[model samples]
Target: MSDTGGLFDGVLAAGPVAESVCDGAWVQAMLDFEAALAWASAAAGVIPEAAAVDIEKRCRAEYYDIAALGAAAVRIGNPAGPLVRELTASVAPEAAAYVHLGATSQDVLDTAAMLVTARALIALRAGLHACADRLAQLAEEHAGTVQAGRSLLQQAPPVTFGLTVAGWLGGVVAALDRIDVLRGERLAVQFGGAVGTLAALGDNGIPVLRGIAFRLGLAEPVLPWHTERSRIAEIAGALGQASGAVAKIARDITLLAQTELGEVFEQGPPGSGGSSTMPHKRNPVAAVLAAGSAAQAPGLVATLLSAAAHEHQRAAGSWHAEWRPLTELLRSTGSAVEWLCIALDRLRVDPARMRANLEASGGLLLAEQVAIGLVAAAQGAVGRQEATDLVAACCLRAGPDDLAELLAADEVIGKYLDRSRIDELLDPTGYLGSTAAFIQRAVQDWRSRSAGYR
Candidate 1:
């Protein structure tokens, strides 16, 4: 049999981050069941008001034997089989028949999964927004906090910690916007019985489906999606892309916090990652977890792509293969978002180290600035190539201290600008064009969009 362990397990092991996704699945399943019952009762006109009230009460208070559920699941080689049995046992005998009327196992399971995905996406958006907020705060706090910008593992030039944080915030904001776009798409449901057509439910099937969706707070689809799994595939793809953003941030943080760099550090207690042999090591464990979880999402997404290839109206094997992997993707992605949020919140930056690193580059970092200044001063007198050559020759020949002294003494260059003005222009803080402003705009936009729901 295929691996059918609960997606909750992977998320729980990571942290409370997966709680929203895990609990949402069970809650969504119950809600779908309620919606189906209510719709069926209204259409049949045989369901009494009192019976509907009792069914609602029982549905909300109902408990399941999870161990038995698991055993049954293994026996039948299906997750919905056990869930259906458990839900059936929870209601009164008279109302039990109407509980899942005209619904196949896929109807309940697929709808429930979509609900879980929606809730998870909401939680992930919140996580990304919170991280963006914190990053903006850090950027503001360290706007003038200059440090060495590295390329190819070598110090290059001066850059502010604020600017780096702003870059991260930009990526996160983009991901959040993508999530908002996806939330509006219709969450397709599987309602067709035995095949793509609703033969089992007779003529009134389409109307019943609309009623069911209305009751469940879902959009109605034109037809059942027994074979059309593109929506699911798309959601998984979006999730993987979001996870990639988190991973990129984690990788950058991990590199920045390296001992040799010493420009930034993780702010949590040092005991998070214990060394088996070495006593002085305090590893960036959260970063490592985020990277690993983010790395796994793409493969899970690929699995979804494979599952989308159904044979005719239904391929039980291919369809079932989607269940566990999709859940795992949700859980892992949720965990990555949570971890990155916390990591960004507690990060510590050292401006002094940044300056030292910049100086270590032997004045090479300011080559571009110097070239620009020369170009401006010469205007039509010097060509771009001559300006670059002059700056490069100056940078290559001068030591860290000698470069500063030489630049200060140069009469032609100093005539157009003083040392103070040059330093200010080259400062990383002055170079951050509109990072904080962009972050504020994103936050406001998100708030306006979410106002109605809140």
Candidate 2:
């Protein structure tokens, strides 16, 4: 069944990760583990090959009743117990003995969780790379497009829009790298039997572990991690970092698309961003949803972290607490990534508006440049403090008047610089320090690192 119909699901959980963590997907992952375990047990000489083949045939998820399993899970504290029981009943009596041979409920469930996570990451990773590629394109396209750089919500100086997008790209690449490492090295199979030891499997336990890892395509853990939950915490932390990165870009887009700012907007077809009450409003809905989705991640990550304090050999409530939060965290961050892709895809920039807004400050944004120019023109006749004081006096007196014109008309300041020199210093584009180089570096880094993304 499709995971649809919720009011905010389309916006908050709209992606392949949503499907990958659904009930059916979880059931299938568990069944896949059961099938793989049977095959692996047979390979380790722990179960007959014919019995393993029979058990595998009955391990298909479609043969099980998910609703019944959910209800039965309450009795045994996990769905794996009910699932194994049903699988055993479905197979012949000879194969039934080997259905879940030497495996505990946590073994199947933990491995299943990893399988589900791996599948979900396949989509999340793709979406992130897509977002990174779009940012790279934006950075290259707007490398020379100058805009005001704001600090603490006020205009500071000139910076290219390309540089702004490049900053976003850098964060995304970092997040992607963290997630890549976790997916490759940490998502391992959990195979120890009850109490963290494969006592039932004895000498064949390691072979069975290797076989399961090979069949399921997951990393082989050195031992069972019934109580050790660092992998889950690591996944949560990486996803939290990714959500933060996506939220940062979304926040920037929303801010730039503000009514007063209007420097950038999410372009779309008619009726895309219409307001229910205000007809003229063109909202950045995608960015807003992306930010909203990301906003829910920290709390979910916290839940996972809290749940990571599992008791020895197994957890009472902590392990169970991780199930929903972990899946929801995946869903929320995945939604953020998907929404960000849509936002960047539809993003339209107004270079003219950016330039106009930069100039709206009336040269105040370039005050630092002006101060530096004065210090140079003084040629050490005036101390640095004196030049700074003079510029500060000019800025205060120049309110509503052009700063360059005000500086030019100042008697004390006019000795070192003229209107021509002042205007040149106030030029926004001329004051962009290393903006192009930064953009190039960001794009180059993305291109090089992304080449190795699998």
Candidate 3:
């Protein structure tokens, strides 16, 4: 079966990055390397300049039959052989002699892979930046909007929604930084001729390599890394981390958008987040799709990591294994980030519902704060453990009676505390310790980091 045009393609592999890694793009990238090689060889006096121009003119991917190239590639175990042969045949005889000079099939394909990766990364970075910007806006706008903080799937204390959004922003910024570093420093050209040595091109090899690097806007490595797959593995790992970050944010949205909670809703266009059978269901479809797309990344990353163990100077099957997994990884990761951006942009918050939920536990959520307050108010009259036990007992009776009223009526607690004092202790707004500060710090850090990204 074919890999493209699935029912879920628009949901799982949607974005410009998908196009950048398609079969046509791969063929074009290989042709680009061949054209660059010819021009670089001519610049280094290794081939005629006229031959370079002739070869360059024939290097357009639109001129070649991509399906026929794939069919021919099966015989040679790679598409580079068929591509180079076709490219050579398409050009004049002198240009054909100069096509893919002093470069192995591996060199052409590997370099083409780098080209494809660099372009796809550009699209991924844009999606990440869009998500980061939306998160920053939500963080700043809701910096003071208090909500119940849950731990282990149960309500615990209070935290601002801004702080939660800030947390998401921090993760996106971190992933963006890693991707930036990889794009700037690690995308090196792969040109080692045959077996990691440019023995065929003699002394002209280094110059041609430099020329190719300059022409393609890729880094010039000290040596070709035929067997070293760290660059590919690193790319996989970074995209994996990015996908994880997107999943975390999306999962939070799905949880918060639950029907029972009702604290947040995804305000997308009509017909989105719909259920066919269940008309009342307004599912968090964007977040669900984002999470599903991200869920596919870890296994793809593992596949790339498994292929890292190449034998000797060149891999037999290991190198061949990286092609499809890496492409899918890039596409899936890009789709996840894009969906997350859409989810956050459409998110609607309910402060009233958040406050109502915060008060749902009848002051049991503030048991810890009340205990600490009792200890301080008692002023050594009651020990810390005594105060803790007193508060725990009061919490047990909180649903039948208000925890504040229960604590104020307790014999041991009533001596040092009044109803007003207990009320203040149980106030979620008063108990959001360091929340605003943390939100500020998170927003500042994101702004500082995103400034460079912009």
Using TM-score, give the best candidate's number: 2
Error of 3 at 2 (Å): 10
Output the better candidate (1/2) by lDDT.
2
lDDT of candidates 1 onward, in order:
0.69, 0.90, 0.90
Candidate 2: stretches off by over 4 Å: 1-4
Encode model 2's per-residue lDDT on 42-70: one tens digit a residue: 98888899998898888778888899999
TM-score of each: 0.83, 0.97, 0.96
Q: lDDT by residue for model 1 over 1-454, one digit each (tens)?
A: 5565455455333645476555445544655656565555566564555556656665541365555665677776765676666666766787667666566677767777776777777777777777777776776777667766667877666666766766776677677766766776666455666675767567767776776676665667788887788878878878888888889889988998788877777767757755789888766767767787788898899999988987887676888898878878888887888878767766777778877776676566777777677777777676678777766666677775666555656665566657776666455455444645654554455456544322
Model 3, span 1-454: residue lDDT tens: 7675878789998777888998889988998888889889999999999999999898888998999998999998999999888888888876777888899999988899899999999999989999988888999899888899989999988898998999998889889999999989888899998788899899999999999999999999889998999999999989999999999999999999998898898989989999989988999899999999999999999999999999998899999999999999999998998899889888999989998999888878888888889889878888888888988988876773477788899998888888888889888888888988988888788777777886
Name the best candidate (by lDDT). 2
Give the poorly placed runs of model 3, Cα more than 4 Å off.
Answer: 1-4, 380-386
For candidate 3, the C-alpha RMSD (Å) to the true structure equals 1.8
Report residue 35 deviation for candidate 1 (angstroms): 5.2
Indicate the TM-score of model 3.
0.96
